[model samples]
Target: MAFTLPFFSAKTLLTTTTTITQFPENPKTLILEQCKTIKDLNQIHAHVIKTGLLVNPTIAENLLESSAILLPGSMDYALAIFRSIDEPNPAAYNILIRGFTLKQSPREAVLLFKEMRENSVEPDKYTFPCILKACSRLQALKEGEEIHAQIVKFGFGTHGFVENTLIHMYANCGKVEVARRVFDDMSKRGVITWNSMFAGYTKSGNWDEVVKLFHKMQESGVVFDEVTMICVLTACGRLGDLELGEWINEYIDMNGLKGNLNLITSLVDMYAKCGRLDTARRLFDEMPRRDVVAWSAMISGCSQSGQCREALALFHEMQKVKVDPNEITMVSVLSACAVLGALETGKWVHFFIKKKKMKLTVTLGTALMDFYAKCGSIENSLEVFEQMPLKNVLSWTVLIQGLASNGEGRKALEFFSLMRGKNIEPNDVTFIGVLSACSHTGLVDDGRNFFVSMTIEFGIEPRIEHYGCMVDILGRAGMIEEAYQFIKNMPIKPNAIIWRTLLASCRVHKNIEIAEESLQHLVRLEPTHSGDYILLSNTYASLGRWEDALRVRSQMKEKGIKKTPGCSLIELDGVIHEFFAEDNSHPHLKEIYNATENMMKRIKSAGYVPNTAEARLDAEEDDKEASVSHHSEKLAIAFGLIRTSPGITIRISKNLRVCTDCHTATKMISKVFNREIVVRDRNRFHHFKEGSCSCNDFW
Candidate 1:
């Protein structure tokens, strides 16, 4: 306000005299006029003081500017120079305050502004913006409000720079309503004005507001820049608004506004999040260069869409090109590993993180725990949870769920207690894990108490997932009639999963009457799910209701439903090998089949019998034995036995539930071969060791 930059010119400085000790007509006028570097300024100032030249106010002001802005990390020296001035003007104070803010000392900047006011140097428009920025960075709402009062008192409230900084200060303090008021009051909004409002809404996670603000900005005809585009695209990605994202892409193309690489990366992220991977990939390929951000977007997109292998491939490609990844990229990679049960790959990721000495942040730590837990290693999950320095509610919740899913239900409940002891309040998600733990551990009374507490004591109204877990708790513990009654009395409509949970419990308890009822509801809910039909048919066969089972199969045929083939996977030597029931497609199929035959004989000798009751088709006893022996999980286990060394633990991942015969045979095989086998199926883990399973045959 009181100063102008006054276009310092190269020719003007070059034409002037250069020796440090030389005399001029007016030394005070020549103080910084002859100065080129901060070092040169210091040398000249020393000579002038030694020569007894009076440090006039103009010369003093020049020295303040030189010290503050000439070099970085010079704020301390600038403060000393300011104290030396007999009377620091508004210009001198503004320069020092702005310098401190930029030098990463917003606290110092605010303090200097206070001192300037104490000295009775009234602040100009320039001083408020810089000091307000410092207040914004510190989230100092009281100081910012005081500054706003001063701004209005001085009649500078309508000044564009001052008002914008005021908006910024309030927004960063989580006062978006105040920021919006400031935005609406602006008489003539500039592009920077609109961009700041957009930035604030984005920071506050008001995605819909960001979209609405973008529309308002368009209606106002304020031409937006790259920053505005980025904010809008970020909102679109969060909302999964594919149509809006595509429209923005078209607008950018129509206007030829494709200069910034970050804008392109935002487009990539938006399209990827919207499930438009092909479009994302095409944009990715067209880019002349790929930064870590661009690569992370595509990888994250691929992972979210279940193209895990493709995500891994892109990660490897990034590595080959020597582009370093940030935390976002690694998180997506861990997600892919968890979904595919790629334990070795996940371990490699862990090792890579350790080698790089990356911080075990809560997000990353939780992801690592999830990956290990889904890979059938709950111990590693606990270890990671312990290693995390900062544990959020999400971190604790994931650990609890991991323990429950891995059949460590009692341990999970203990962990929940520990989390509570640390004063962390459990939310709806935490209750889901706790209820599932009760289901898995058969703590029916505890489940009932906790379910009631979650609603009445904690004020967390039960969600659909919570109700489903409650059904699972009762159903899983052989309270089949009570579970059916609970579903009938549900306040919320029972989803297919709720009915399915009850049906599964009915099967476990041989409650065929309820099983038929569940099927009737399921037919209207999810008619094409082949799993429900197979489950009911298996229930009938288990009860020796052959005619009913056959009738169910005939109805399935009439409805054009085909049984989803069982599939399993085993990972060895960093390669995932897949198998279907009776699959002979693997390169080592001959060895795998031979191993299966030999393994079945050994397990049978160890007292394992063929559980042929739940076969899809009733056949001769010998034929039934052949059918169960060639199951997908059996083929996968056989492959592991042939390819892996003796005594090495084998692990398999199955898409569906492991059936009765495979579960029994695997237990015997584990004891007979003196090897531990871990199988991760759709819902939970089954660890077979010493002729017993972690589930105790309940699952």
Candidate 2:
């Protein structure tokens, strides 16, 4: 438990030893009752002079400062009055500077400092803090240094008031080193001094240093404030230090700092980011009131943790409470909607943005674009990108990645070129999108050259994801040997993704030897992961090696591993409906089954065969066919086709790769039913139209 600021602000540091002269039934009470406007203030100024109240320099300077405080816009009138005084004191200068700086007129305040020095009015201990704050606000580091020298020259070097502001100025101007020197040299340190240095490090994005400084503060036994905790909480969140975050929560309670809204919000944010959603929500619900930022933190955390339904529910509760959401909140909502394929709800949010006339910030626009693309509305994604007035590297990455995910691989590469042509340097993420484009479209040469150019042309050292793309590129192109060699030769060690990529390619290309080898490596790397086993088993099943497939399945049983159940989601009227393989829980089970049965009959007539070879069950052909017929995606697609109007494309989100039988059936179903079917599965998107797929049977 430590001391607490309860609240913190730069204006708190702008305090002065000088106090405003109190009037006794004078200008404020007697004559200035109608002084509502600047004009009335001018009249009052003339009257005060006519009454001979401004007798000497002392009274004149006081009046001048008072008028400035009263009419903040009447800086010109205050200056005129100040000039009329024979000699304005340092208190007069400090008072004016503090007023202007706190009112968001830092430039004018600094200019007054220059004028004060020109008139030979040397600044005192009080003057340095106010002027230094002005320089901090303006980020005028050179001027701050000049003021630092003046502080030393005026014998105010050792004053805590002056040194604290000096640290604040240096920190605000990104001079953390200089600020730390000031902090270290201070013989007498208090909570404000420590808070000032911590604030500077937080502002400069030295998060690790923030945590380190807090430990030092604890050792020093300086009672810290809410501001100090905020900095430490932020660092803990970024570093995912849940243990420290829990300790912070306990410390807050032990110290009786729970009533502070900012401190509570910071705790909520930290707990949520560290994956303690239940704890975060408890803290959030216990609050008497919530702001947009607190709501945003919770919603975004839900989205990031794959709790899309919880996220959307929180957003709905937020709306009912009338706490208006800002851009950050909307972005998180859009992300949740995207994952759930809640297209209608996402559109409503988009409309809300337009209705509020909120500018399309880069992050918000990118989120919208990603939502649309994931919902299978690629055109809407493109429109959002085009309408964005400002774009950064993140913006371009989202667009390119969206295009790639929507199966517009060629278009993604084209935009990558456009991005490079515009002098927007491609970061590591941008290259992942670009390389993925080449992999999906079977652009092997392009993928290879781009992989090399990542380091050569862009100077972006290849990451694991980039290397995985190359493995996928070669594997998908039926170059199994080269893909395996690539893995072996990787400068960085191959992760599970690379081996899995090569395994998948071996399955597709029927390279059984390499597939088994890849599975062996995966067994060592991820012995408990069910994915590699499933893929290798499927590889065997596809090639009529059921004994090998059954053996793998037995190994899974021995390890107490079960394949993840396939689940698919379809959105209708802003509501997402989920279906599992052979699901029987839906209220519309009879109708959905009937619809699925009829759709299968029609696709069978259109020459869709039951590819039971893809089935993992070691059962009779009929049982395998029965199981494959009602895979989660088919059930979800059936529901979509029955509820939606004819000719409207149906979209599905699946938690696993689309089985071979499902993919072939969907292609025929699209042609026979005269509808497009868009299914985004675990790996990529497949757009089924006219008995052909966007992947061109490669996937």
Candidate 3:
């Protein structure tokens, strides 16, 4: 029911008319219209109450607008005055509806519109625009369609404002094609209409369509704005088209467009994502102001491009500069920590997150879980996983991968069962992790069953990675003949990595015939890869075929193929130190060498026999021992022991697989020095403690 008030009468309203005539115009109206502050509006409200001027609908509308639209968070005051009116008009309803929409409470606006309609308050052109905006914000496509029918019923189909909103509603609801049809039927087009479609395409990840429409907008000579450029820059970034991004940057500068923080951040992100870190950093430094997003873009780009250490340093710089990090920033920083296996630093980040009271969102939780898993802390990874309020496929996959890589294959499989019980469908990555767990645990039958079920039950078509995992499972189980037949019968042509996996297994089991076959396929598939030739050489060397080993090396030299030297990274005091095989480039070279010598002597005394046969060096025992002692992992571990306190865990990241000799030596060192060592090699993680490894020496 409409609320009534006896505050206004014919005689009292005459006082407002007399007052307005005496002022030669509507000065009270001007005060209500032009008042900038709530305090000024409050004084005008007092004047309205004293003069009983709200009975004049024009005066009341202005007052309601000033309260609801001009002053934010004053909706209560406007609604109080609106309800006090005996019969609020359409203008007053429109004012409140627009206020609710702008305040991001669109549902409230929809409710108010419903109330207005039920009360028989006829809507104006302004009313439809306001409510349509609410529909777009709410993504209420069904209700928006009903409103469209009403617009046609009212013969307002040709109205530009209403039609423009209809286009926006469809676009935001992921109905881009319907939006396009509406746009095509329009007799007149506005710049906002074009921008709406561009934004829609971007939301749909249709970058190619975005670029096409951008050109179309340009051809139509419709002046575009910063919003258009922002969407275009996003497309350029995702496409990794550095040339196009640079051209857009030039366009911005040439047009003298005002550089807002959003635009600048987009440019920085585009350059960073395109692998132009230097350009990104320069733009980042030159920006007059920086926000968390600008910092996150650069950090994430650095992490994704394998500059993990650099990304961590930038994250520290962000902290020192007092730019608060959001969830995205934390995700990027955690990714860097995972890459470097800097568990100490990752722990500090976790502490900071808790201290800051940041919400443990799924993305951040997954990152923390991944960091612990990669850092050889699977227990902690499981804790993070269980504590996460929400778990997506990514979260579950990380935990499974972490457990599988840490040699907890049975546990990973059990967790997969639990996930299935919860009805959480697994994706391709999850299957890869499950297959890897099967391979690690020697569950051949289970692997085969899962592979078949992946298609028959889950409808997940096996990709190349899944096939590779299956081959690895069979190969690692010592079924060389079966693995070979599996590769031969593969529906998809096995790539070089798949062939290399088979060859490595052949080397492990000393299957000469299969090794030669796998090498033949690998050589043809990747003729220029020095590693491929080196693998063949190693296979021959394992079988004591010196002549064949020499032939493989000779072919490599003839083709100018230089093997990638093994390098290892050890993080000490939050700084990463790198060492190459036999490279004495450190300032403490003499001390590091002496430490390695002492470590080797002690380990030998503890019955550690050096496996010098696998050494590529075809020299005397002493020469081979000397060469193997200075390998990258040994140097890094020696340096770590010499510099760090005793009993401290040493973490190392190796560029290539840890050699058999180095692996054995590291196991002995872990026992001798009473230190736990975690090494992340090219393939998986190895945690050595007390003369044992987490992989049980299978890796």
- Identify the candidate with maximal lDDT: 1
Model 1, runs deviating above 4 Å:
1-19, 23-124, 135-156, 613-623
Give the CA lDDT, 0 to 100, for residue 226 in model 2.
84
Over 452-547, each residue of candidate 2 has an lDDT whose tens digit, in order, gives 998998788998999999999999999999999999999999988899999989889999999999988988998888878878888898888889
Ranking by TM-score: 1, 3, 2
CA lDDT of each prediction against the hidden true structure: 0.86, 0.85, 0.84
Candidates 2 and 3, the one with greater lDDT:
2
Predict model 1's lDDT versus the native: 0.86
Model 1: which residue pairs collide?
A: none
Q: Write the per-residue lDDT of candidate 3 for residues 634-666, one digit (tens) a residue.
A: 999999999899888898988898887898999
TM-score of structure candidate 2:
0.84
After superposition, candidate 3 runs with Cα above 4 Å error: 1-94, 101-187, 257-264, 285-293, 421-423, 541-554, 616-621
Worst 10 residues of 3 by lDDT: 1-10
Which TM-score value belongs to model 1?
0.88
Instruction: Give lDDT tens digits, candidate 1, residues 1-699.
Output: 111122234345522233323355454444445455655556655654565553666666667776687665666777887887777789889989988888889998999898888988999989999999999999999999999999999999899988888888899999989999999998978998888888899989999999999998888888888899899999999899888898889988998866567888999999988888999999999888899999999999999988998998999899999998888999999999888889998899999999889999999999999999999999999999989999999988999998998889999999999999999999999999999999999999999999999978889999999999989999988999898889889999999999999988888889999999999999999998988987898799889998888788778888888777888988888788889987868788888889899999998887888877645454466687788899998888888888889998899999898887788898898999988999999879999999999998867
Candidate 2 displacement at residue 20 in angstroms: 23
lDDT, residue 586, candidate 3: 84
